[model samples]
Target: MGIVRNGHEASDRWSYIRRFLGGVAGIADDFLGWWWRGKDTLSPAELAAAHEQWADRAEWRLAQRAEELASDRIKRYLVTSWTDSVAYTSRRLAAQARGELSEWIPQRERRPDLHTEARAIFADILTELNIQSQPTKEQSSVVHLRKAG
Candidate 1:
Protein backbone atom coordinates (compact mmCIF):
# COMPACT_ATOMS: atom_id res chain seq x y z
CA MET A 1 0.00 0.00 0.00
CA GLY A 2 2.85 2.37 0.71
CA ILE A 3 4.35 1.79 -2.71
CA VAL A 4 0.98 2.28 -4.37
CA ARG A 5 0.37 5.47 -2.46
CA ASN A 6 3.84 6.78 -3.36
CA GLY A 7 3.24 6.00 -7.02
CA HIS A 8 -0.04 7.89 -6.98
CA GLU A 9 1.56 10.86 -5.27
CA ALA A 10 4.38 10.94 -7.81
CA SER A 11 1.92 10.79 -10.66
CA ASP A 12 -0.06 13.65 -9.18
CA ARG A 13 3.07 15.73 -8.73
CA TRP A 14 4.15 15.08 -12.28
CA SER A 15 0.78 16.07 -13.63
CA TYR A 16 0.78 19.27 -11.63
CA ILE A 17 4.30 20.16 -12.68
CA ARG A 18 3.55 19.46 -16.31
CA ARG A 19 0.57 21.76 -16.22
CA PHE A 20 2.58 24.43 -14.48
CA LEU A 21 5.38 24.16 -17.04
CA GLY A 22 2.90 24.33 -19.86
CA GLY A 23 1.58 27.56 -18.41
CA VAL A 24 5.10 28.93 -18.20
CA ALA A 25 5.84 28.04 -21.81
CA GLY A 26 2.61 29.63 -22.88
CA ILE A 27 3.44 32.83 -21.02
CA ALA A 28 6.90 32.93 -22.50
CA ASP A 29 5.36 32.68 -25.94
CA ASP A 30 2.96 35.48 -25.11
CA PHE A 31 5.76 37.64 -23.81
CA LEU A 32 7.68 37.14 -27.03
CA GLY A 33 4.66 38.05 -29.08
CA TRP A 34 4.01 41.11 -26.98
CA TRP A 35 7.63 42.14 -27.23
CA TRP A 36 7.55 41.79 -30.98
CA ARG A 37 4.13 43.28 -31.42
CA GLY A 38 5.24 45.82 -33.95
CA LYS A 39 7.29 43.31 -35.87
CA ASP A 40 4.70 40.51 -35.61
CA THR A 41 1.69 42.64 -36.62
CA LEU A 42 -0.52 41.53 -33.76
CA SER A 43 -3.63 43.59 -32.99
CA PRO A 44 -3.92 45.83 -29.94
CA ALA A 45 -6.16 43.41 -28.08
CA GLU A 46 -3.89 40.56 -29.01
CA LEU A 47 -0.90 42.43 -27.74
CA ALA A 48 -2.68 43.28 -24.52
CA ALA A 49 -3.71 39.69 -24.13
CA ALA A 50 -0.12 38.58 -24.62
CA HIS A 51 1.09 40.93 -21.92
CA GLU A 52 -1.58 39.75 -19.50
CA GLN A 53 -0.91 36.14 -20.31
CA TRP A 54 2.81 36.57 -19.74
CA ALA A 55 2.23 38.20 -16.37
CA ASP A 56 -0.06 35.38 -15.37
CA ARG A 57 2.39 32.76 -16.49
CA ALA A 58 5.35 34.35 -14.79
CA GLU A 59 3.47 34.58 -11.52
CA TRP A 60 2.39 30.98 -11.76
CA ARG A 61 5.88 29.78 -12.65
CA LEU A 62 7.36 31.63 -9.72
CA ALA A 63 4.85 30.18 -7.30
CA GLN A 64 5.26 26.64 -8.54
CA ARG A 65 9.05 26.71 -8.89
CA ALA A 66 9.48 28.43 -5.54
CA GLU A 67 8.98 25.14 -3.76
CA GLU A 68 10.75 22.70 -6.05
CA LEU A 69 14.02 24.13 -7.31
CA ALA A 70 17.16 25.18 -5.48
CA SER A 71 17.16 28.82 -4.57
CA ASP A 72 19.41 29.49 -7.55
CA ARG A 73 16.89 28.15 -10.05
CA ILE A 74 14.19 30.22 -8.44
CA LYS A 75 16.40 33.26 -8.62
CA ARG A 76 17.26 32.50 -12.22
CA TYR A 77 13.60 32.27 -13.12
CA LEU A 78 12.89 35.52 -11.33
CA VAL A 79 15.68 37.25 -13.17
CA THR A 80 14.62 35.71 -16.43
CA SER A 81 11.07 36.87 -15.89
CA TRP A 82 12.19 40.36 -14.97
CA THR A 83 14.47 40.65 -17.97
CA ASP A 84 11.80 39.34 -20.29
CA SER A 85 9.30 41.79 -18.88
CA VAL A 86 11.74 44.65 -19.29
CA ALA A 87 12.46 43.68 -22.85
CA TYR A 88 8.79 43.53 -23.66
CA THR A 89 8.10 46.83 -21.94
CA SER A 90 11.03 48.49 -23.63
CA ARG A 91 9.89 47.35 -27.04
CA ARG A 92 6.45 48.74 -26.46
CA LEU A 93 7.83 51.97 -25.08
CA ALA A 94 10.14 52.33 -28.05
CA ALA A 95 7.32 51.68 -30.46
CA GLN A 96 5.13 54.24 -28.75
CA ALA A 97 7.95 56.74 -28.82
CA ARG A 98 8.24 56.24 -32.57
CA GLY A 99 4.52 57.14 -32.87
CA GLU A 100 4.45 55.66 -36.36
CA LEU A 101 3.52 52.34 -34.85
CA SER A 102 0.27 53.55 -33.29
CA GLU A 103 -1.61 50.92 -35.23
CA TRP A 104 0.41 47.97 -36.45
CA ILE A 105 -1.50 46.96 -39.52
CA PRO A 106 0.02 43.76 -40.84
CA GLN A 107 -1.55 43.85 -44.29
CA ARG A 108 -1.21 47.48 -45.18
CA GLU A 109 -3.07 48.49 -48.31
CA ARG A 110 -0.38 48.66 -50.96
CA ARG A 111 -0.70 52.28 -51.86
CA PRO A 112 2.15 54.57 -52.82
CA ASP A 113 1.55 56.44 -49.59
CA LEU A 114 1.96 53.19 -47.71
CA HIS A 115 5.55 52.92 -48.89
CA THR A 116 6.35 56.44 -47.76
CA GLU A 117 4.66 55.90 -44.41
CA ALA A 118 6.44 52.61 -43.91
CA ARG A 119 9.80 54.14 -44.74
CA ALA A 120 9.33 56.91 -42.25
CA ILE A 121 8.06 54.56 -39.60
CA PHE A 122 10.89 52.13 -40.25
CA ALA A 123 13.46 54.85 -39.88
CA ASP A 124 11.94 55.97 -36.62
CA ILE A 125 11.61 52.41 -35.34
CA LEU A 126 15.19 51.59 -36.27
CA THR A 127 16.43 54.71 -34.55
CA GLU A 128 14.68 53.77 -31.33
CA LEU A 129 15.65 50.11 -31.46
CA ASN A 130 19.25 50.62 -32.54
CA ILE A 131 20.35 53.66 -30.58
CA GLN A 132 20.59 52.75 -26.91
CA SER A 133 20.91 55.60 -24.46
CA GLN A 134 19.96 56.83 -21.04
CA PRO A 135 16.40 57.92 -20.50
CA THR A 136 15.79 61.53 -21.24
CA LYS A 137 13.52 64.16 -19.72
CA GLU A 138 10.62 62.28 -21.23
CA GLN A 139 11.72 59.02 -19.60
CA SER A 140 12.39 57.46 -23.00
CA SER A 141 15.72 56.50 -24.48
CA VAL A 142 17.15 59.23 -26.71
CA VAL A 143 17.01 58.44 -30.39
CA HIS A 144 18.42 60.82 -32.93
CA LEU A 145 15.95 63.53 -33.78
CA ARG A 146 16.21 64.94 -37.27
CA LYS A 147 16.73 68.65 -37.12
CA ALA A 148 14.69 70.61 -39.65
CA GLY A 149 16.94 71.41 -42.57
Candidate 2:
Protein backbone atom coordinates (compact mmCIF):
# COMPACT_ATOMS: atom_id res chain seq x y z
CA MET A 1 0.00 0.00 0.00
CA GLY A 2 1.39 3.38 -1.05
CA ILE A 3 0.24 6.87 -1.71
CA VAL A 4 -0.90 7.87 -5.18
CA ARG A 5 0.51 11.25 -6.19
CA ASN A 6 -1.64 12.92 -8.76
CA GLY A 7 -0.95 16.37 -10.22
CA HIS A 8 -2.57 17.67 -7.04
CA GLU A 9 -2.07 16.77 -3.35
CA ALA A 10 -1.52 13.73 -1.04
CA SER A 11 -4.47 14.22 1.31
CA ASP A 12 -6.35 11.34 -0.33
CA ARG A 13 -7.98 13.85 -2.63
CA TRP A 14 -6.20 12.82 -5.85
CA SER A 15 -3.25 10.79 -4.66
CA TYR A 16 -2.87 7.25 -5.93
CA ILE A 17 -3.05 4.31 -3.56
CA ARG A 18 -1.49 0.92 -4.08
CA ARG A 19 -3.23 -2.36 -3.55
CA PHE A 20 -2.11 -6.01 -3.28
CA LEU A 21 -4.51 -8.84 -3.87
CA GLY A 22 -4.85 -12.54 -4.76
CA GLY A 23 -2.59 -14.55 -2.49
CA VAL A 24 -4.86 -17.53 -3.04
CA ALA A 25 -4.06 -17.84 -6.73
CA GLY A 26 -0.34 -18.21 -6.08
CA ILE A 27 -0.91 -20.61 -3.17
CA ALA A 28 -3.35 -22.83 -5.06
CA ASP A 29 -1.04 -23.31 -8.02
CA ASP A 30 1.67 -24.63 -5.70
CA PHE A 31 -0.67 -26.91 -3.77
CA LEU A 32 -2.37 -28.42 -6.82
CA GLY A 33 0.90 -29.28 -8.59
CA TRP A 34 2.38 -30.81 -5.45
CA TRP A 35 -0.69 -32.97 -5.00
CA TRP A 36 -0.60 -34.37 -8.57
CA ARG A 37 2.91 -35.32 -9.55
CA GLY A 38 3.57 -38.63 -11.29
CA LYS A 39 0.67 -38.98 -13.72
CA ASP A 40 1.60 -39.36 -17.38
CA THR A 41 -1.65 -39.49 -19.32
CA LEU A 42 -0.50 -38.52 -22.79
CA SER A 43 2.47 -38.18 -25.15
CA PRO A 44 4.69 -35.08 -25.11
CA ALA A 45 3.92 -34.15 -28.70
CA GLU A 46 0.18 -34.36 -28.14
CA LEU A 47 0.53 -32.28 -24.99
CA ALA A 48 2.44 -29.62 -26.91
CA ALA A 49 -0.30 -29.42 -29.53
CA ALA A 50 -3.01 -29.03 -26.91
CA HIS A 51 -1.01 -26.31 -25.22
CA GLU A 52 -0.70 -24.46 -28.53
CA GLN A 53 -4.43 -24.70 -29.01
CA TRP A 54 -5.11 -23.37 -25.51
CA ALA A 55 -2.72 -20.47 -26.12
CA ASP A 56 -4.51 -19.57 -29.32
CA ARG A 57 -7.87 -19.57 -27.61
CA ALA A 58 -6.58 -17.48 -24.70
CA GLU A 59 -4.89 -14.93 -26.97
CA TRP A 60 -8.01 -14.40 -29.06
CA ARG A 61 -10.23 -13.91 -26.07
CA LEU A 62 -7.78 -11.52 -24.42
CA ALA A 63 -7.49 -9.44 -27.57
CA GLN A 64 -11.24 -9.15 -27.69
CA ARG A 65 -11.44 -7.96 -24.10
CA ALA A 66 -8.69 -5.43 -24.69
CA GLU A 67 -10.65 -4.02 -27.60
CA GLU A 68 -13.78 -3.72 -25.47
CA LEU A 69 -11.93 -1.69 -22.83
CA ALA A 70 -10.02 0.47 -25.27
CA SER A 71 -11.72 3.72 -24.22
CA ASP A 72 -10.03 3.66 -20.82
CA ARG A 73 -6.25 3.56 -21.07
CA ILE A 74 -5.74 2.61 -17.44
CA LYS A 75 -8.41 -0.05 -17.68
CA ARG A 76 -6.82 -1.22 -20.88
CA TYR A 77 -3.52 -1.72 -19.08
CA LEU A 78 -5.20 -3.90 -16.49
CA VAL A 79 -7.19 -5.83 -19.06
CA THR A 80 -4.11 -6.27 -21.19
CA SER A 81 -2.28 -7.76 -18.23
CA TRP A 82 -5.17 -10.09 -17.61
CA THR A 83 -5.34 -11.12 -21.26
CA ASP A 84 -1.60 -11.67 -21.46
CA SER A 85 -1.82 -13.81 -18.37
CA VAL A 86 -4.59 -15.98 -19.86
CA ALA A 87 -2.52 -16.40 -23.00
CA TYR A 88 0.55 -17.35 -21.00
CA THR A 89 -1.30 -19.80 -18.79
CA SER A 90 -3.18 -21.20 -21.75
CA ARG A 91 0.10 -21.96 -23.47
CA ARG A 92 1.28 -23.90 -20.46
CA LEU A 93 -2.04 -25.62 -19.90
CA ALA A 94 -1.99 -26.62 -23.53
CA ALA A 95 1.29 -28.38 -22.79
CA GLN A 96 -0.27 -30.07 -19.81
CA ALA A 97 -3.25 -31.06 -21.90
CA ARG A 98 -0.90 -32.94 -24.24
CA GLY A 99 0.77 -34.59 -21.21
CA GLU A 100 4.14 -33.31 -22.35
CA LEU A 101 4.52 -31.56 -18.99
CA SER A 102 3.86 -32.74 -15.48
CA GLU A 103 0.97 -31.14 -13.62
CA TRP A 104 3.16 -30.64 -10.53
CA ILE A 105 6.31 -29.24 -12.09
CA PRO A 106 7.41 -25.80 -10.78
CA GLN A 107 6.60 -23.93 -13.98
CA ARG A 108 3.38 -25.80 -14.43
CA GLU A 109 2.29 -25.28 -10.85
CA ARG A 110 3.16 -21.60 -10.66
CA ARG A 111 0.31 -20.60 -12.96
CA PRO A 112 -1.18 -18.35 -10.30
CA ASP A 113 1.98 -16.26 -10.24
CA LEU A 114 1.25 -15.16 -13.77
CA HIS A 115 -2.17 -13.97 -12.64
CA THR A 116 -0.78 -12.30 -9.55
CA GLU A 117 1.78 -10.42 -11.61
CA ALA A 118 -0.93 -9.31 -13.98
CA ARG A 119 -3.04 -8.03 -11.10
CA ALA A 120 -0.09 -6.16 -9.71
CA ILE A 121 0.49 -4.55 -13.08
CA PHE A 122 -3.17 -3.72 -13.31
CA ALA A 123 -3.45 -2.31 -9.79
CA ASP A 124 -3.54 1.23 -11.06
CA ILE A 125 -6.26 0.41 -13.50
CA LEU A 126 -8.29 -1.25 -10.81
CA THR A 127 -7.92 1.77 -8.58
CA GLU A 128 -9.05 4.08 -11.35
CA LEU A 129 -12.12 1.92 -11.78
CA ASN A 130 -12.85 2.19 -8.01
CA ILE A 131 -12.83 -1.57 -7.57
CA GLN A 132 -12.04 -2.81 -4.08
CA SER A 133 -11.85 -6.06 -2.20
CA GLN A 134 -14.32 -4.69 0.30
CA PRO A 135 -16.74 -1.79 0.54
CA THR A 136 -15.39 1.33 2.20
CA LYS A 137 -17.12 3.29 4.99
CA GLU A 138 -16.49 6.57 3.21
CA GLN A 139 -19.94 6.64 1.69
CA SER A 140 -21.66 5.89 4.99
CA SER A 141 -19.48 8.40 6.74
CA VAL A 142 -20.66 11.08 4.42
CA VAL A 143 -24.27 10.14 5.03
CA HIS A 144 -23.70 10.17 8.77
CA LEU A 145 -22.21 13.61 8.61
CA ARG A 146 -25.13 14.84 6.58
CA LYS A 147 -27.62 13.47 9.11
CA ALA A 148 -25.76 15.04 12.03
CA GLY A 149 -26.28 18.43 10.39
The candidate maximizing TM-score is: 2
lDDT values, one for every candidate: 0.43, 0.47
Candidate 1 matches the true fold with a TM-score of 0.29
lDDT of 2 by residue, 1-149 (tens): 32433321223221111111112112211213322442244356654554454345435445646556777655665656555565666567655566556454343245566556556756865785776654479977887889999
Off by over 4 Å in 2: 1-42, 92-149
Q: Summarize candidate 1's per-residue lDDT along 14-105 as a digit string, tens digits.
A: 22122222333233333343344432454554444444444444455555565454555435544554644544454454455444355433
Which pairs clash in model 2? 4-15, 4-16, 47-98, 51-94, 51-95
Cα lDDT over the full model 1: 0.43
Model 2 C-alpha lDDT versus the unseen true structure = 0.47
How many clashing pairs per prediction, in order?
Answer: 0, 5
Prediction 2 TM-score vs. true? 0.35
